[model samples]
Target: MVAQDEALTRRLSRRRLIGTAAMATAGLAVAAACGGKETSSNPGAGRSAGKEEKPRKGGTLIGAQVSDVNMGTGYPFVLLAENPFLNYLPVEPLVRYRNSLEPEMVLAERLEYNADRTKAVITLKPGLTFHNGAPVTPEDYFFGIDLILNPRKYGITGSFQLAGFARFITDMKKVDARTMEFTFDRPRANMTDLFAQLPVVHAASYEDVKNGKAVAGTGPYIFKEWAPGQRLVFTANPNWHLTDREGGPYLDGVEVRFFADQDAMGLAYEAGGLDLILDAPATLAKRYRARTRVGPKRGLVYAGLNVTSPLLRDSRVRRALFLAVDRERFVNELGEGFGTVTVQPWPSSSPAFNPALEASFYDPEKAKQLLKEAGFSQSRPLVIEHRTTQTYVNIASVLKENFEAIGVRAELKGTEATAFLAKLRAREFQDVWVTAHAFSDLTPVTNFQQTFPYQVPNPSFYENPTYLDIIEKLSGIDPLSDEAKRQYERFTQLWLTDPWLLPLQPTVPVALLGAKVRGFDEYFLAPGGSPNFGTIWKAP
Candidate 1:
């Protein structure tokens, strides 16, 4: 295990070096294109050199979102992918990830872990202030941590998402004005990775934030206006600390208009009404290849089986359902071949990702035989109520046909995003639920500890002592260690034998930028593909 850990560290270091070199080379290319001139300090000076453009400061970027930003109770703590602006623009996590997947400090200037990894000291960047003009101190971090760790007291839905920390963090206190300390119940190998997901906010503004009266953060943008179902507006933070580029966060403001769906957003983009489409529909990838920036596979579309349901209680029935679906078809048709068919949730870059299991679970004939062995037949067909949001209704439809082909009757039910999420959180789905989940790329442990479908007391209501033990052990060991890999493989084998969540394919996040949009590629590097408007600028 020690050897494996050392080797993995070496490989990751090499990968980070390569990624850094590539980015440096790209920066040089951009500099050469612009005649090696510095970006203008003047917000209005939009310049170009030899047909290549440089980042300009003054523009109100018009971005489009497929759905309204649902600022649920606890506001930014809910961490919904649909509400990207709330996650990144108005609030910032302590740590963010670069393209190399290495931690980049945001609010935190340094994090030191004890030898046993059971204690941590976090030092905030000095002089950081929230948008409300209050200093960002250790108390603010404690406030946010309290809200997450004691969700019942705050009536929020975030504790379950950070179960690892929620279960292990025994005590937290302020060490100093700019420093905080955390004591864990056990050693946690992925402490920094977990911190990358936690966003800190001003504690004094809790009531205002809860009531939707105001929002404040130490990020690069200040929340200005939110027009319910129509649009939300933000202005650049003039006092932002990061100063990597001249007049950085060059856009003066950003306006995010909410559309009914992707098609409407695409039409708006074509008509020059929008400057950016954060997650363009896969079907439009080819049409906008030149303008689109593709990122690594960060999420997976999976079917969750409710083990409590009689129709799916049998392991044979569940395994049959897994084998009946054609994941490749979902990739080619729904994903437009922009994704890879995967039997497990981990991304290709993850140490837990097993090449042997890639696309190895499809066999219609075997699926039919398994269904027969489980007493399912045309005369006595197994019926399943599959619930999902409209965004994933297409995949659910395909699943219906696939199940029927294997002698199972599948009923499809689609609901609004809010209603679907409510049901999902409540674990009220009858038999099956299909949806896409992120966080599979952060750290292998995150998928099991954070994702709703994979976490303990999961939405599927499927529990095995062995699986629980494996995940518990996984949390305490180095994620890239051979022991961790073996545990993940064991978990995968057990899941296959008694399948609950059927992973279909991993979806690569693709963002389309307008011809004049620049610096938006930085969005792909942040955790969970959250858009970093701070680095994005217009080409004038």
Candidate 2:
């Protein structure tokens, strides 16, 4: 399943677990019944989101993860999309989302906009310092933007979003040590959300970061050791803003252990080797959902058709592929009713979600007709490649079976994550590939831009200038105006008609937590299944 990028690392696995209070099941039920009114925090918040237990001080929490931290640039380089759960703990953003998903002041005390809303002036919070004892400065903020916009020797993603900001914001100037001003070429919506996701680091430490040496930030944790494929260790930042009296990180330190198998991670958790299991198999998650926290994730698992490929170039073929697949069956059998069928990227919670879009019929006869009209037959079967995870392999198998029912022969190709990403970026594929793409920002513009044609290599070579223009126009639309509503509905229609990629379902990620752990907030689930470990403590 996909995790929210703005929050934590998104785990690809289906199931995971974390801790909860004695009344977790009842609380979760109440929260769900209320439409998440009380549990508005995003997924991966652990059990702390709804519990009232007073936090105590001092304990070490151990977590088991499936991926290794070999990237070495997990700190301040989360844009590279590696080890964000580890990297983001030591570094913080200027602003962050509260439980309401609203922008909350963090390092930046206040953010203001000009009359036209084209410029933003920010004032930093006083008395903030990096873990290395260096006071935070406006130069550090500018440096963070530069690192993302014009990255040098940094393995990063999100360049598109950063580049867009730099393109629209004509200039940036530091006013003082703790203040700065940004002038935009045009009015932009969701400015705080965009800036809140950038990782800030001290400018003086850029060289150290380039040399693979870790630098401390103003976050609650201090980097101690990153043992690559084994485990990562972090200690409490003594000089952090949140003091013990303020309910600051009650843990003395935190450890993240890496395991190759989900079963092994579960075993470690069951044997008390791990305090939390962020992701696990569905069967295992079923046992702990009542005791631990469980909820639906805000991401979608979809199939991206290679628009450039000969087999999938025809619109009819793409439509046929979408029509042939039984999304409801996939959700029922593969997802085991844990997920909801998705025809588009937006989750049901988002205003952009279209109810009518889900009514598309599963017509095998129509799919066969489209394939025949597109000049395809069993002799020339369509072949698609996907990542080789067991869960994804099973999903692909279900899709293959559905395609066969329509007299359309389909071949499934499985590969590792690294290889799959490399090939995808290179635009090397036959028909389509499965991916769990989720947007950290809830804005519809981001949903369109990321999937729209840009210079960078994306899964779908869906280059349409008109669609791009509409996306830009939507960005400036007044949220509550009739025009904005019209634009939203128009975008929905465009998405249903063209559908650059086919969304199968919104993944429901599970977490497993040990009974001793406390202050595990269910809102901690970021784009990745990772949580803010600093808020959590252990009971005596």
Candidate 3:
């Protein structure tokens, strides 16, 4: 899914089958040493570039962020806002991704697929213990899987990812104490992409975890403290199994300071109070050019139309709304020229990306005509609610202007980050909402099944049998094959006709690192583009 060279493509394709565990393990080490395509303005930001320096240990790495880590239900399954804190830091997944975006073993010692790929086996690494000092077992992994798939019973957000997994995995069985077998409905390739999303939890402490009373994981860090709306702290795990970096995490601990907004976070980083800033604003990027590292454009910013609404149910109205938005303006102004106007969710690197469909959808006059035909005009404008969060207020404002230009009345409703995300996940919005979503950088199946806007029976409430059938067929075929491309084209055409989710632009991921921060390439290049504190170190 990512932009890969010939070598990377061969390696990924070869490693997707059985008997390549040793090769995959070696690739992980190589990726760790070489990093990915993360480009820093400064010449000497990564290990393989400029002059290399030995990483110093025993210092706290302080990171500042505007969004508070909302540990909703204390489960790291659906809520992506908790990823930097929960996934792969304290709670480890069966596999971890390298900078090249290949899966590497974490809790899983071996992953094997049978011929035709309908069956698979996962062997857990032995002698693993949770942060609570309890042995890590196959049951714990199963418990986490069950909890995610049955979101209603767990009181957590229902995940499209688990639904995608359910489509392939018809049954699962515990083969032994350290191994589990999976039976799929059909042949499946690139199984690691699915496994990488599941983070195992200690079943014994799950009740406490769900209640927010305790935290237990088998990762490189142990959860220490969390002050709501202020900060979160984690100490190193001395016995972390991965010995690639001299046996354990380089930092003694990590402290994440929460700010009300990006400005506040940038100020803290400028004053030397914080060592890193995720998704740094353009102002900070310019001021600290040398210290900033720019990653791939992996997130899609789009408008999710609520098709259940009476007005939005009309195909004409949805098409008009999509046409009214100025995608170029949003890219140049809101994104500060750090994004590309896209007609679809997939990036240019993806096999699903079609250059023929990149034509602009912005047509104010056509939008006006469509609105008038749909029984709305300047005399009696169509009123709609526009839901958004603080981060997208400016984008919403621009959209409001765009809609008004087409003789439509738009009302902006802004909510906090946590509440906004909850509403999006629950499909609680009345009209339409604008938000950015990740997972476009992964496999096309993951993008369809993981992102809220792209999920089946999505928040938009728009459904078509043909579109569903195409997606189902696409899931079972080779992603790089001609048939897969034809399916993607058919699906894209169907989506354009309905226009449920209005495509906007793709934004680049940028982070500001302090002069002393080292080994952050993996964090920036990781899947989902969230920070992984395991390899990070603070220079003394």
TM-score of each prediction:
0.87, 0.82, 0.86
* Candidate 3 structure quality by residue, lDDT tens digits, 225-304: 87877887889888887756434588998888888877777777778898877677766776777777766656577788
Candidate 2 Cα misplacement greater than 4 A, ranges: 1-53, 70-84, 152-161, 207-215, 243-246, 358-361, 377-381, 425-430, 450-457, 524-532
In angstroms, the error of model 3 at 199 is 1.0
Candidate 1 regions exceeding 4 Å error are 1-50, 155-159, 245-247, 377-390, 524-526
lDDT of 1 by residue, 1-540 (tens): 224324533443333110011111111100000110111112222224355556678888888787787765455665675776666777877776655455668888887778777888889999899999999988887777677667668766533466555567888888889988989888776666667777778898887776665787877788888888889898988898875632477889889998877778778888878787766787765576667666666767788898988788888888888888898888887777776777876655566665555674778887887777788544343433333334477778888888888778767777777777777778888888878788776666767887888888788997888889888888777665556656766776676678888877785666677767776644434445665566788865
Number of the predicted model whose TM-score against the real structure is largest = 1
**lDDT per model vs. reference:** 0.70, 0.61, 0.68
TM-score of 1: 0.87
Among the numbered candidates, top lDDT falls to 1
Q: Candidate 2, overall lDDT?
A: 0.61
* Count of clashing pairs, candidate 3: 0
Clashes (N, CA, C under 3 Å) per candidate: 0, 36, 0
Candidates 1 and 3: which is better by lDDT?
1
